[model samples]
Target: MGKCSIKEAYVRIENGQVYVCNMNITPYEKGNIFNKDPLRPKRLLLHKSEINKLAAQTAQQGYTVVPLQVYLNGSLIKMEIGLARGKKLYDKRQDIAKKDQRREAEKEFKVRNLY
Candidate 1:
């Protein structure tokens, strides 16, 4: 799955169907503005069979479904969904430490390259 920014998007489930809700795709500046509304959110439908299977698994394990990334593949838009469980305080601290370590490593690499 690719990483991308989704400032205003959410996952929605209705009648056992999964959807990417409130996803805003900006209209082309030179395109016909009157024909499209930029403020309107585009609802993306996910594969029903796959989503159903994942939902069943996550439900049985007491995990929640969360959208991790949103991106476009050619003409189709895709969302990466994940089954997530709530993290404990120590888990959060461990994650933070890992992130910090990675960041520091990157910074050191950049500095070494400059020499």
Candidate 2:
């Protein structure tokens, strides 16, 4: 299902097709030395339907999908990707506003509950 412990990801466009690739993870341990030449390709397992959907998106002129996250799930590693169409400036602003509102509401609720 997975190749190794994935720490990061990168998206690349090759031949007009969008592909997500795994970035090497270097542990920040004292004895460990970071290797810059450790780039390797990792295979992603997805449902046939999902692959078809991604294929369709890639075929489009201005649409591309990319990996958003890669993390450990129990002892297994899982990757999460986005079927993204580039967001407009307003969309980003709206997302920030919504997050701020949610955070403020949570803060108010927590403050009111204090004895």
Candidate 3:
């Protein structure tokens, strides 16, 4: 079975520590037995320079740091963070309409080719 999707995802920074909240990972079958639980959120210990950079970026008005993706890179875990601002309601609606148009176009294309 596939892993369940996370409902609420966010990034939290406190006292120079970064954590990816509400993220879940499957436990490896042949992994170490004494390893911490994979389901629990782990603190990402970034370099001092990286921490300072993220802090500075998030300190600006209307900008917040968000974790876009988290995955295992080789034997180490990695997270991709982005600086993002909240979207307006109209912008969200436009995005939804674009998605619907693209989906409809794909459906039409599939039907045309299925003949």
Candidate 4:
């Protein structure tokens, strides 16, 4: 299914190809018996040059390919990925705090608008 949670996914290079793993794609409601594993690895279709570039970049120490987003272009679906370094505990905590602040601000904005 097109609707999926790619937050837990990471990229892997195998046999000169790119694969995204740990993504959870929701199963189609009506296709109950035919549903595939939601957590299966999915391959990314890219040009040879692009794959080579990604492979080279990810070969660096502590660098990994991260899936940023998924979107549609006309009838074809595309995934956006980038090379990223692992985040430290402090950085993760800061990000969580920022997200919480944004959420609280959004809540306040909605409450003020309800007058």
For all candidates in order, the CA lDDT equals: 0.68, 0.65, 0.76, 0.91
Give model 3 RMSD, 1 decimal. Answer: 4.7
Ranking by TM-score: 4, 3, 1, 2
The sequence of per-residue lDDT tens digits that candidate 4 reaches over residues 1-115 is 5788888899999999889999888888888687899899999898999999989998888899999999899998888998999888999999999999999999999999999
| RMSD (CA, angstroms), candidate 1 | 5.6
User: Candidate 3 at residue 27, lDDT?
Assistant: 67
Task: Looking at model 2, report the run of 10 residues with the lowest lDDT sum.
Answer: 1-10
Candidate with better lDDT, 1 vs 3 = 3
What does the lDDT read for residue 87 in candidate 3?
88
Name the runs in model 4 displaced over 4 angstroms. 88-115
Instruction: List candidate 3 segments past 4 Å from native.
Output: 1-8, 27-39, 96-115
lDDT of 3 at 88: 87
Instruction: Please tell me which model should have the higher lDDT, number 2 or number 4.
Output: 4
lDDT score, candidate 3: 0.76
Q: Which residue pairs collide in model 4, if any?
A: none
lDDT value for model 2: 0.65
Between the candidate structures 2 and 3, which one is better when assessed by TM-score?
3
